[model samples]
Target: MDFHLTPDEQAFRDEVRAFLDELLPPGRHPSDPEFLSTWQRRVREKRWVGFSWPREVGGGGGSIMQQVILKEEMAKRRAPALGTCFMGLAWVGPAIIEYGTEAQKQRFIPDILDGKVQWCTGYSEPGSGSDLASLQCRAVRDGDHYVVSGQKIWTSIAMWSQWMILLVRSDPAAQGKHDGITCLLVEMDSPGLTVRPIRNMSGTSIFAEVFLDDVRVPIEQRLGAEGEGWKVTVSALAHERSSIAEVEGLLRKLDELVELARASTKNGRPALDDDGIRRRIARFETRIAAMRMNGMRFLTKQLKGEPLGADTSINKLHRAALEIEMGDLALEIQGSDGALEKEIDGGRWQRFALSWPEVVIGGGTPNIQRNIIAERVLGLPKD
Candidate 1:
């Protein structure tokens, strides 16, 4: 893939930089409610909120390269995200756009773009995480509604989200486990549905164990046809596995590590002067650059209108390992003090140290990604 940007791409990058200067000036805090509100509003107004979606559905409909340019500029500036709804804009909205009825689009897309609703995915279950098609969350059709009954674990943002893009066994007796699944757009407040938050190692309650006991969902809210959820899942998961989204976050953390190293002393000398520390830092930066290139490859394929496939697993696996490595390296730099809850940077490093699994094992485990790469991307025979 060509590394050089075309003239139009360069101009677009300049445009994004200018937008940042005006709206996200240096020292701006994205966490500030007023600033964040204003920023989201401005980006939404400029149609950069959902820049990759179709224009007819109130999206910017920007080209793939343009989207890359936009995200790159924003990340370089450490600016806030373009939209507030995380899962909504990333995969859920795209899935809806692909398989949802026209009425569903009109009903859901606008809220997603405007960040009026939060969406949580309901794919993983007690029995079906990495092998998602084996999910047994039942959703039996009854008149105009489907009665859902089952449980999902490690459901991120389940307690906070207003909606769930759920997958269930709508046809339990179908020919295969993969063929019996169906996707549903479920409301969090529905009767018989329960959300019990799980306190993770990081001391946060973002993940949850969700139970659906005869939760009635209108058939109209079914995301795709019965027995076709496996296809929908495969497509949505491809988006989930794209590691491009994690690039900016890793870059920011790398910057923090660099700063920490400069301030730290080892053997009565600056830690930055330690050859070992320098090498580890360099290794991280190199890996990050590689992930960036992988991201570009994904973009390149999209530009050519090719379907994204298992190549995304390469980056996904890299990102999972990187998150853990980065966290461990940061704590290593802190030495003995790293173990204390509030030792370095008010325990930010400690929090990061404990937070690897969410990224490492969220979409798919590292082992799972490798299997995908070996068999699907490399054409290696599966044992």
Candidate 2:
């Protein structure tokens, strides 16, 4: 497939860049705690939150290619990502469009696009992580609502979110594991809903533990037909893959590492002068380039309306592994200073190293991705 962008698409890229140049905060760090609100406001101001969505849904109604261009430009600048709403705008929004009733769309779509409401995924529980279908969160039908009661762990940004797209067990017992599941749109303010932050090595509360105790959700809040949560989840995962769009950011980090190495001293000489360091940088650069190409291929398939399949797992696995490797290199370059808790002249690398674990475990574990590749891509037998 041809990899070049048409002139029109190139112009679109420039437009996105200029818009971001004006919209982005004067200075921001990817690790900043308040970065989410700042970036969310800018997205609202630019009206660029839902780039590829339909105009009727409070979006730009732009093409998929335009969306890809927007992500690339944002990454090139190393600007903070659009925050945890990535899932809301890309996955939940699209899912609602496909499966929600007209009233649901009218209520949620505008709030999502305007950044008035942030959302979190309530899929993983203490007992269920990769085996999501075996979730135990129960939702029993009451008079005018479903009374939900369970605990969700590792919910990203749930503490600050206004809503949660949750997967709960509507039927306690069914023939198959995937049966009896239902997707529910739950308001954070609902009675009996509580959020507790979980602190990570980065010294930040990036994820949370969400508790539901007889929380009532209206019948209309259900996303699709009952017992079809598996379908909704699969569709959400597809959108998750499309929205990751972080390959360019990874490349930019690699570029920063190169400059860091050039300036870093190792045994009275620049780290770039060290043979081992040079080789490591070269390998990272090569892998990052391959990742960019892989991302482009994924985008092309998406443009052609082809299914993403297990290839998304491949991308996730590679990208997560590379992030850890880059973090490792950063730590090595900093030597003893890498272990520092706060920013010293050269100690901030420790933060990068500490944050690597989250990237690996966040979207899906590497082992889980491998399982998907084995069963779906290679057509291997399941254990």
Candidate 3:
């Protein structure tokens, strides 16, 4: 694939552009809170904050092309999120360093690389979304503690997580629906959970619903055993398709939809001097350079160890149709000031076209990534 960069990955991309030019020095504003706690304590004293998780779990054991050049130089400086423990550094600390317990990696990998807490993901319910293994939520077990009871819905940041990673059903007669499920780690105050939130349509409650009632948990916060929760959710959805390193947040939303089509205006002037808006922004930069060469051919078959699966649903169905065609061409170049919110890019491309459910139904949708590329990458046949 020889996608260049290998003088030690161009000196690790010049040591991440000299630490973002000395800790975010351009026009400042890395979102402040004491400048993001001094840029998360200078990238957590250079461990580069979970840089690629492995150095005895606190992470930054780099390389995977230096974690794709430190997330493409922190998404070309949109910065802010190296680690605030969002979904506990995505995919619950690599599904607790691959199915936890060594005291769940000394109790949750040093508070998820020191961002303290916050993590949510229960795995859809309300009669299962995208047939998430027909989840029922149950739990049961008991004696050493298990109880649980149903309900999850949407979840994401479950009204400000404290911990979750759930998914239940403990063994309802085991037969199938990915067999008896079960993978815990709960907490959020436990005593019969609750949550609620859910707003969406971009009004944003960042999703929620939860519930539970007989909660409990304990048995050292179960994570692997009991019918192996669909093999710990198929090894945490195969390390969450390395979230195709969000192709640097869709190349910083196509450079803010090309500076909102050069300060928008059509028929009479600019709209990037239209040629059908520069052929739909050059077909969204050729489908974001074919999703960065299909994420570097799945990082060169994960650096040759191979075994990558369903070809990351072919870049998650080409990033859910290039984020709904670049949020409907940024509200069709803001025609009616894109349904106003005091326009001029203020409506934020009409709230990113009403934030399509974390991209047309989070994690799995676009018809379940085209049925995982028509039955596991085209072997086909499974109707």
Candidate 4:
């Protein structure tokens, strides 16, 4: 695949770079509340938040390559996120655009792009073993509403979100693995809904267990048709997994890791000067390059209208391993100082080190991704 940007793409890249330069001057941090507010407003005005979506729905209607260029430039400059609603922009918006009613699109897509509301996904179940198809959360049709009951585990941002895209089993006797499943756009404040945060090893509760005891979701809130939940979910998960495989974010992390090594001491010398540390950093760079190339290949396939399948698992697996390795290396370089929860670097390295489980297991586990690659890509017999 050709990595070279076309003339139009190069022009777009220049425009993005110029915009970033004006928005993020060298001394100003992107995180400042004042700057962030202005940043979000400006980006939204430019319609860069949902850049790839249709312009009719308040998106930029930008080309796929242009979207890539925009993200690449933004990440390179460490710009504030294009929008405030992470999950919404990442998957929900796209899914809604594809499968939602006109009313649903008008009601939800604008809020998602304008960052007016947060959306959480209710997919995983406690004993489901990551097989979303087997979710036991049941939602039964009752006149104009569906009364949802059962629990979802590992729901990210459930406590803070205003809405949830929930999946439930509407039929237990269906013969197919994915049959009887339904997707509903549920209001978080529905009477019977409850959220309980689940603290991880890092002591953060970004994930939660969501319990719906006869929570009534209006029939109109259902995304896609009944029994079409699997299709909608598969599309949403594809968007999610692709976002997880972002090479630009990994590159930024690599840059930070390099700086960390240069500033830290290892056995009486700068950590960056240590042979082992240097080799690891080099390997990281090489792997990042491989990821970039793979990304370009995926882009090429997308341009050709080919559906990306098991090949994406390779990047997902690489990202998980790279994040773990980089986090550990940062701690190793910091040595004993890394153990302090509130030391220099603001415990950034320590936090990163402890945050590995989410990345390693969130979208899909390393083992799951490897299984996908082994069976689908390599055509190996499933065990």
Please list the C-alpha lDDT of all candidates, in the order they appear. Answer: 0.87, 0.82, 0.81, 0.88
Error of 4 at 304 (Å): 1.7
What's the CA error at residue 127 for candidate 3, in Å?
28
lDDT of 1 by residue, 164-202 (tens): 999999887888778888889999999999999999989
TM-score of each: 0.96, 0.91, 0.34, 0.96
* Of candidates 4 and 2, the better by lDDT: 4
Cα lDDT of candidate 2 equals: 0.82
What is candidate 3's lDDT per residue for 4-120, written digit by digit as tens?
787988888898888888888889987779989988988887888887788877787887778777777777777887768877776778777888888898899889788888888
Q: In candidate 4, which residue pairs get closer than 3 Å at backbone N, Cα or C atoms, i.e. clash?
A: none
Which residue window of length 10 is worst by lDDT in model 1?
Answer: 236-245
lDDT (Cα, tens digit) per residue for candidate 4, span 204-242: 898999999999889999999998999998888877534
Q: Candidate 1 vs candidate 2: which has greater TM-score? A: 1
Question: Which ten-residue region of model 2 has the weakest summed lDDT?
Answer: 339-348
Better of 2 and 3 by TM-score: 2
RMSD of each: 1.5, 2.9, 19.9, 1.6
Error of 1 at 46 (Å): 0.8
